[model samples]
Target: MGTDETTGAEPRATLEGFLRARRDRVRPEDVGLPGSGRRRVPGLRREEVAILAGVSTDYYMRLEQGRERNPSPQVLDALARALLLDGEATDHLHRLALAGGRRSRGAARPERVNPHLLRLLDRWSDTPAFVLGGTLDVVARNRLAAALHADFTVTDNLARMTFLDPAARGFHRDWDRSAAAVVAELHKAAGARADDPRLSALVGELSLRSTDFRTLWARHDVRGKSGGAKRLHHSAVGPLDLHYESFTVNNADGHGQQLVVYQAEPGSPSEEALALLGSLHTLYPENGPEAGAGTRTGRA
Candidate 1:
């Protein structure tokens, strides 16, 4: 992501900041522009971007300055191409442009998990499953999911755990890659929930407290919940390799939640590890990793 002076600014200001940040990240050579040693600013200049995007420099400047709030879809598509944005980044750009309409109406209400969804999680005792809210908060989880993530003192927020928790380095076998991915996903979520106060507070806290998180956040990377593989080192069960699938939970409530389920190969060592973890969960139902931890409610 590109950087601009958007802290505490409204949706329009945030839109500006994102554009500047992304523009700063693109080098002259990156977009086939000649690298001039006499350049004064980092990344491509505003004129350069305007030229590439096939728009007037003044018009493009207005977009970043918040003088122009809406651009035609064709113009936006051109800007996206000029910026070399991927699918996720392009989607985020569109959301920011539209967020102004929603942000002015009112803040969004907090999200809650469905009771039926909770019951479904309980029934999947063999599989580790959890639900994540917009802020990547652990809103709901099965016993196995709790056990899988029990090593962390705070299982409520995944982003905090990845950056602030010391155990995260060992827990995630590929810490750097996972950390980057988590940061990117948070960026994507924030774009969708631009007016959510909770999201703002979380971003602020992480930016102030963790240097690594601050660095990643500035990159303006955007990613959504998707299927992937993870290698984990559990405190009790040792090493385990698992694959995960993420599903969007769509219902009348419009919670916009993601259901993430983890599974291991049937005859693999990871499967054996999962069974052992399950047994421990059963034996120490009261003192286990997620013992008595109720589901999280409200906005992240």
Candidate 2:
């Protein structure tokens, strides 16, 4: 395991941290075990997890303590079953175990959206489309997307806008759900590249600044942004119920760029509202110094 350069102490292994967090979320009765007596911890005891996973208590302890880093696939599967982890979380577990404290080899370069992709986004004049970099940075966005997110003080990063921007609560009708999903998506990305300095810095900033972010981040939930519905209260449109789809950009650079597009349901009130928003933008185009002045739209 790697040691912290400043402290000269070993950092907690990623696999160990993930295992401990997941273990703390599994209740005794969740896996058909008896929940009879009072316990010091919130979730299943370590020994109980061992029993459920069909592993020795000592071995399980070693796994949690980072002393044992190379568990076989069978053991990983058993542990996933024991913890009742979902598909995404199970995959995250396998990734952490496979990483085994190895840091990424080279420094990361700034992500650039392909010109072709930018043109594609511009073609969707009525839709809100943007490209998100590996650390959830808004690398490129169409005019509609820019207009939608005009309320944010900093639109460069989605995670920052979601947690730090004061407008986030007002924009996202379901603020709590939005917060949890953002944290979980960031967790999944961070898990894949544990040593990315940008991710580390962003996580640290959010953890220090937002109490809600700290709480959700500690849970270690892992999920990707695929497709979902969003309920938003736009400053101009009043209310919008939009569905969004995310696609991974298959670039040779492997920077994990994602193309996200948002649309309203056909014939719904939200569709009318969206159209009105588009028309408003067309009539009063935000150009020069006035672009992205006082509007508010959130990333779903």
In order, the Cα lDDT scores of the candidates are 0.78, 0.78
Q: How do the residues 139-172 of candidate 2 rate in per-residue lDDT, one tens digit apiece?
A: 7777777777766676768888999999999999
For each candidate in turn, give its C-alpha RMSD to the true structure in angstroms. 3.9, 5.0
What's the lDDT for residue 218 in model 2? 70
Clashing pairs in 2: 151-295
Misplaced by over 4 Å in model 1 are 1-13, 283-300
Q: Which ten residues in a row have the lowest lDDT in candidate 1?
A: 284-293
What are the runs in model 2 whose C-alpha is more than 4 Å off?
1-13, 280-300
- What lDDT would candidate 2 get against the real structure? 0.78
Cand. 1 Cα-lDDT: 0.78
Per residue, candidate 1 scores C-alpha lDDT tens digits across 231-297 of 9999999999999999998851554688899999999999999999988666422222222233443
Error of 1 at 15 (Å): 1.6
